[model samples]
Each structure stands twice: as C-alpha cells, then as structure tokens.
Target: MSEFIQEKRQYPRKSLEKTAEVLDNDTGLSLGILEDVSKGGFSILTDQGMRPSETRNVTLVLPGPQGSPHKVSLTAECIWCQTITERADFAAGFALRSIEDQDEVALNYYIRDYQVAGQKAGELEES
Candidate 1:
C-alpha cells in the first residue's frame, strides 16, 4: 500500500477555468488554461511542458464584478509538473512571487465569490 502526502497550502484554492497566457522569455507567449486559483497562486494546464523550478510571468484575464474581463499579472515559479496521459496538456503548479494590492483584492474577491456560490448551490441541492 502506498500513502500520498498532502502539501499544506497557505491559501485555499478555488476551481476556476479561464484562459490565460504565460510570458516566457525564450518562447515568447504560451497559452494555458487557469484550472484553479487562489490569492496566492493558481494552476495552469498548458500544451507546452514547463520544467520544474522554471519561473515566468503570467497574465490572467479574469471576469470582473461588472462582467468585463480584467487583466492581472504576476510572477510565478513552477513548483511541479506532470503530463496528462489522456490529453496533450501538462499540469503545472505555480507559486506566486509578487502581486499588486489591487490584484490581490480582485483575486480574493473572485475566489470567495465562487466559494459562496458553490456553498449556496450545495445547500439548495441538499434541501
């Protein structure tokens, strides 16, 4: 029997599926999907495989409160990478290096809003 160890995260991540771009110094731009997000960092599923320990700047186009998309940029370092067998995409975990105050607020709002909505839905289903 094998036991898997769970990593403790500083912030809880909420599932979010949104298109984003990774700005690579050598490769220019790489497209990826933002799978889950938190105020601290987010996971990206990309066609290009990012080596572990690689760092890059990512720009996330996230939906705003008014329904318009807003751009948030952050420097991130890849913690781990794994190839998805069934798909061509590679899943990568990124740790956010730095973020602006406004960007942090926006990210927190998006995560909390989703969590609240999900909880409400679950309650409705149970009722």
Candidate 2:
C-alpha cells in the first residue's frame, strides 16, 4: 500500500532558468547551485555534503531585473541532505534563519519576477 505524505512548506518554491550560485559568505567559496527557492527556504545541489542542523552564512547570486545578477545574503540552517547516487552529488535543504531587510526584498523580487514559474518569465511550471 502507498502512504500519503503531507506537504509542510509554507511558501511555494520556484526553480530558476539558470541555476543560481550559492556561496559561503565567510570563505567566499562556491557552495552549490541553487535548485529551487521559496520565501522560507531553499535547496542546493552541491558536490560537498552538508549535515542536518548545520548553520551557514550564505549569499545567493540570482537573476536580477534585466539579466544582471543580484546577490542576496542570509543565514540559513540545514534541514536535510541526501546523496544522488547517479550524479554522485549531494542535495541539501536549508531554512532561512536571518536576512537583511534589503536582501529579503531582493529575494522576494527575484522570486516574483525572474523565476521560471514567475509571472514575467513564465518559462517552466512550478513543481
């Protein structure tokens, strides 16, 4: 028998046209490519594994109003991480813990305007 799983996400997630790059703020190193994002959290596809409950200061490079890249800084806590056997990469989910007012505004704009499922872009349907 198949069991039903309840959805727990507060905000809807939107995938990007080109994967956004996630960076470790402290080290300025590339952490991974942002797979999808929402107001509350985001997920990353990375080469390195992340432990659950781990906290990080990260910057996301997102597509801006006119094809330019905009960076949004925030503190995030890792919620889960799993390995993709075929790709040999890790996919990690993180919840937003903190963000500056300006960064938060920018993130909201990116989600509303540039995302694949966003009104302006309207490229891919939301998953």
Candidate 3:
C-alpha cells in the first residue's frame, strides 16, 4: 500500500508546456506536460488514460520561471483524474507526492510570493 503525503505550502504556479513522463512503479507508461502547478498540488493535462486513485512516479522537465529548464521528479498519486469532454484538456490533480527538502525551500519561497501577491490583490479589490 502507498501512503499519501502533502506539502506544507501550496505554490501558485504558471502553466508549463514541456515533456513530462509518468511512471508506474518502475515501468514507464505514458507522457504528458505539466499544465498548472502549486506547492500543495498540481494538475496535468494528458490524453493518456491514467487511473486517479493509484500511486505513480512522475518526472517533469520544464523551463523554470527564470527561463531555464529544470527537472523535478517526485512520487505522486492521482487524487482526482478526469476526462473533460466539453473541453479540450483533461486534468489530473495530485497531492505533492513527496516534496524534497530542496524543492520545499523553493516551493516555500514561491508560495510566500503567491500569498503576498494574493493578499495585495484582495486588498486592492476592496478599494
């Protein structure tokens, strides 16, 4: 049985259109690109049929916000996976798998920025 783990912070991330591969245990099955990201979770858009309630090993290679490509590999299980018939994109939301210490630091910084910006925006909205 696989254990579910969540991160401390949820980052607000942008859409990353890069090649991403999803692995089940030690076997490679399908590939997709990361759609949107956050520290707590992320959504992937893929045409392949992957079970949501199962654990998976995912490796995502994307260009970081600085415009350099960075690879992040982690173990994640699909909390919710669905196929969108009305829309062209299918989304799969997964918990943070296992966020590494280094990645957590980066994610914390990103999440902090996201929270600050959101707070500022909310304040502005009231104005």
Candidate 4:
C-alpha cells in the first residue's frame, strides 16, 4: 500500500509556460531548470543532489517583459530532494529565504504573467 502525504504548501504551484534556469550565484554553476513555482517555493529538475535544509544563493533567469531576460537573485533553503532518473538526475524543492524588493516584484510579475494554468510547457505567449 502507498503511504499518503499531506500537502503543506501555503500557495498553489503553477506550471510554467517556459522553464526558467536556476544558477548558483556563488559558483556560477547551473543548478537546474525550474519545474514548478509558487509564491513561497519552487522545484527544480537538476543533475546535482542537495541535502534537505541546505541553503544557497541562487539566480533565476526569467522571461521578462518585451522578450528580455530578467534575473532575480535570492537565497533559498532546500526542503527536499529525490533522485528521478537512472543517470542520477534529481528533483529538489526549495523555499525562498530572502529576496530583494525589486527582485521580489520581478518574481511576482513572472509568476503572474509567464505562468498560466493549463498552458503547455515551453509554449510562451508572444510579447
């Protein structure tokens, strides 16, 4: 029998029209691509494994207004991680810990406009 897990999210996650790439700010390494996002947290599909409770400074490359690429920098804490592929690809969940006011605004705009429910993955609306 499968064990049931309760959903503890404060905000509902939304699927992105286009996946955003997440990078480690300190190392300039590509951590992963964002799979789903919410106001509180997000999940990424990555090749790197992260331990729960680990913290990192990250930059999210988001699709901006007028087709420009906007980068939002923030600190995040890992909530959970699981290996998802035979080649050791992992899916990790992270909670946003800190963000600048301007970056928060940009993130909110990206979540609102770029992530619409029922939109097919990688299908972005024309600007």
lDDT per prediction? 0.69, 0.86, 0.58, 0.84
Candidate 3: list runs displaced more than 4 Å: 1-30, 85-89, 108-127
TM-score of 1: 0.75
What would the per-residue lDDT of candidate 3 be over residues 1-127, giving only the tens digit for each residue? 6596664434445443344344443665455556666666667777766677777776655445656645566777788877886533567877777967876676545433332223443332110
How well is each residue in 1-127 modelled by candidate 2, as lDDT tens digits?
6598777888888876686899999999999999889989999999999999999999999876667889999999999999986643999999999999999988887776654744464564443
TM-score for each candidate, following the candidate numbering: 0.75, 0.86, 0.58, 0.84
Model 3 compared with the native: what TM-score?
Answer: 0.58
Task: Give one digit per residue, the lDDT tens place, for model 1 in 1-127.
Answer: 6597786678777665344444553455655777777767778777878888888876777766666777777788888889995644688888889877887777666666653324544432210
Task: Rank the models by TM-score, top first.
Answer: 2, 4, 1, 3
Candidate order by lDDT, decreasing, is 2, 4, 1, 3
> Which of the two, 3 or 4, has more TM-score?
4
Give stretches of model 1 more than 4 Å off.
2-4, 17-30, 115-127
- Which candidate number maximizes lDDT? 2
Identify the superior model by TM-score, candidate 1 or candidate 4.
4
User: Candidate 4: how many backbone clashes?
Assistant: 0
Candidate 2 segments exceeding 4 Å error? 86-88, 117-127
> What lDDT, from 0 to 1, does candidate 1 have?
0.69
Predict model 3's lDDT versus the native: 0.58
Candidate 1 residue pairs that clash: none
Model 2 has a clash total of 0
